[model samples]
Target chain A: MSTLIGVDWGTSSLRAARLDAAGEVLEERSLPRGILTVPAGGFPAVFDEACGDWMREPGALALLCGMAGSRQGWVEAPYAGCPAGFADVAAQLTWIEPGRIALVPGLTCHEHGVPDVMRGEETQVFGALELLGLQSALLVLPGTHSKWVRVIDGGIDRFATFMTGECYGLLRQHSILARMMPAGDGELDAAAFVQGVHHARRSGTLLHAAFSARTLALFERLAPAAVPSYLSGLVIGEELRVQDLRGTLSVAVIGAQALTCRYELALATLGVTVTRVGSQATWRGLRAIASTLQGTS
Target chain B: MSTLIGVDWGTSSLRAARLDAAGEVLEERSLPRGILTVPAGGFPAVFDEACGDWMREPGALALLCGMAGSRQGWVEAPYAGCPAGFADVAAQLTWIEPGRIALVPGLTCHEHGVPDVMRGEETQVFGALELLGLQSALLVLPGTHSKWVRVIDGGIDRFATFMTGECYGLLRQHSILARMMPAGDGELDAAAFVQGVHHARRSGTLLHAAFSARTLALFERLAPAAVPSYLSGLVIGEELRVQDLRGTLSVAVIGAQALTCRYELALATLGVTVTRVGSQATWRGLRAIASTLQGTS
Candidate 1:
């Protein structure tokens, strides 16, 4: 049986999967070392330590995605523009070691006269399309930099990135918003989340709305426990409102359950149907890219 | 010289000025140490280090405002509710030393179903009203947490705090928006700033509008030097938008020139007349509070 290595190398961690020719996961491993961890000329060494054992068999191809293909990444695959699909990405693959290992390029677009870019979400987006046979839809990949992608006719048309998760992290941990919130994990408050979503949808700029998180606590209107969840909804809601997805019939929210669920709740409040999908899109996407490269070879 | 100390003690720094009965500045002093530097029972020592030299006189009385009176400040001066004036705040001063050292109280308002509080801005707002001798005016005090106050007759009606400056600081320093911008203080690009204000006024949520700061750079529509100014305009614009200040005839923008000009430009874009007032509002406000206390004594 033919086997392949599918690796998702990001800013903070490395996640790798060993998949068969049929794209079935045989084994999976994760390491803390991402491209950022690599010192001077340390890519091969880090890759070996993380996934070289799985790559012991020659002819077994490896396909990588994420920041690994960024400018500061292992090898710059550049970026394929919007309306790009698997073939477009695979065509631009930078071969660290041809056939043995290749990295997929990300997607870039000038939407609304603004240059927007996404690295790994392109892979997951294409993956979601192939897995669900989606002809056209809006896909949201929630993360540190959450992306709202537009896919049409089996290709990415354009996408916008909202620094929702990253902003949330900074607000909850570093900004004045942190003053009212309790430390560590807490239960999700759906009511507060919904309220936050409603606030985002209804009126005012995020500049003023953000203060509600703190004021709500000061007034004893919102408990400290719910501040984080409220903030999550506040930011996520702002993202959803800004995307103005009210007209979009459906949106595919693909990511970890925790993050996607927040998007799902916020989107649902906007009257748009939401389809929750797991991180499988990454694997499916990497596999598709790898297969296309092999076919051309 | 009948001298008195007017202190604006905040979270990070202590600013003090000795004013005679005429409310004219005699001697001014500023120290890096604020409420944050005060250790357990160390307020007196820190106070001495900062302004104790002037306080050695027998008849010298100190009127302090700002974070020094917060729950975490020098002394907990309970907040006076809205429609609060000099009497309302001065009544709540938690005197460290009777008639000698008095800290002014902040103002709290449950305006829009959320609890909001202001410490130093309360003093500044009242000070601005008395200094400008204006009635029924919307007072805008720009700072880390900008306050939009309402003054009627001779009292503070109510106010809303927008974290415009604080939020701007976070986005410029910590968020993904920082990735594209050049480091350190760049000259304010008024043209770029006006563009940002227009964008904020034109469309989408602040969440989406903020991303434009980065995307504008990516498209080469904006240069790196202008990002900070654009960001400043963006948040200030949002603050103006959410304040629903369109109908207000004129706004009293009281703060440092740098922050107030951004607000002035933004408010002017909205067609609302803006009246720029200096940081003298803080000193004037404290002087008013001190005179009231003396009259009561």
Candidate 2:
């Protein structure tokens, strides 16, 4: 039986799973994976500490995804264009340390004349497809740069990136919206979110209407704590409206549980059907990519 | 001749002028203001210390403006509605210590079901009217909450407030825009600002589109520093676009020296004629209001 290592290295955390040839996770571990924490020469040590036990037996091929493959990661892998299949990503793979280590290439989407880039989430989307038995569907990976990717026949057809998480962080930490909002763990105002979505849809320009948040606060004295949630709804609603996703297939959201819930709620408000997928999809997808590469799937 | 006192208490600084029976500046002094610096009970002591030498005389009527009259300040004054001449604010005045101390009421405007409130800046606008010797025109007070006030025949007819300064602060301090932006004292980016204005005018729904700053950084690889300037242009441009300035006689921006210049440049891009008024306008306006009370100008 062949053994595989599936690695998901995000901005702040890293998770790796050890799986048998059948794609069943034999063991898994998570650790701090942010670039700030891992120095240039420290990745090897960190990786060894996390997955050393599994690799000791030999014949274990490791597949890594996310920021670990970015320019700042263990090895830089160029982005593969959308309409790119698993084989395209496989073809562009870079070997970090010869036959034992392989890194997945991130995906890029050129839509609306704007080039959208993804690193770790692409692997998860691939994993999601494998887990759900989806041949073609819309996959939504909600995060700092939330991505809406189109999957068609085991290939990434197209995708669009929204700065939803980044914007939320900006508004909360820097803008006056921060003053009005309270510090809590992902608490949101559903009613305000709904209203924001409606407003974003009706408003002609999304950016111009953002000042209305301050306007609402100054005029109506709306509670500050609700501003962040309202902003989230506005951005997401505007994305949905601008993208014209009226006839898209059921949306599959992949992220942490809390983020998935928020995306789910926002999409539900728009009367769209969505399914929640976990981060484990990336692991399965990595294994699947390996299986396909070895001609053993 | 009735003696009067004019006080301008802003977020971070407080200036009080003691006037003789002729509304002349008998003596003026300034101190650290802001809620953080002056504890609730410390307002009176700070005020007295700043203006005590001039307050030695008896029966002086005091008029206060700015954050001092905010909910968190010396006393909270209820908002007076637009077309809200001096009479409306005067009517809703809350005398902290009647006769000895009186707070000048901030102006409020309600148009198309939208309400905007202003405190210290209104005094400056009123002062600008006194100084400029004009009654009807667009008064642009450029600051954190940039107020575009319409003065018709010696009365504040209507106005709108834009969070230009606050947004600038947030973008510089907290957003990815901060990465490329210079420190707070950084110079202007003429090209980036112009592009920002053009982009803002063309983009629809600013709230959603505001994230374009970060998107521009990630996708277009625009320098992080240029982001704030771009955001500034976008916001100022949106303000200009939304405002109904088609028939206005002229635009007068009242603020500090540097900000006034930026406002001039922004307005110049739109090919609109504008004038820059100095910060002294607030003092002059306070004097004018005091002159009216004392039957002297």
TM-score of only chain B in every candidate structure:
0.95, 0.86
Give the alpha carbon lDDT tens digit for every residue of A1-297 in model 1: 358899999989999999876676889899999787888678888889988888888678888899888767887877788778667887888889866888888888875565777878888988888888897889998888888888888888878777777778888888887978889748789999988887766545666678888777766788889888888888887887767565787899899898777877777776787888887888888887777755555
* lDDT by residue for model 2 (B156-194), tens: 888766666776666567655566555753567877777
Assess each prediction's global lDDT (C-alpha) against the native: 0.81, 0.73
Worst 10 residues of 2 chain B by lDDT: B202-211
TM-score of model 1 (first chain only): 0.96
Of the true interface contacts, each candidate retains a share of 0.76, 0.23
Candidate 2 at residue B283, lDDT?
Answer: 66
* True-vs-predicted CA distance for residue A89, candidate 1, Å: 4.1
lDDT of 2 by residue, A1-297 (tens): 468998888778888999877677888889976654789888888889888888776678888988888767887888888888877886777788776788889987753444567887778887888888888888888777778788889899987666567666776677656666667626778888877777666654344345567667766555677777788776777666655567864689888897787777777766777788886787788887788667331
* DockQ, all models: 0.58, 0.23
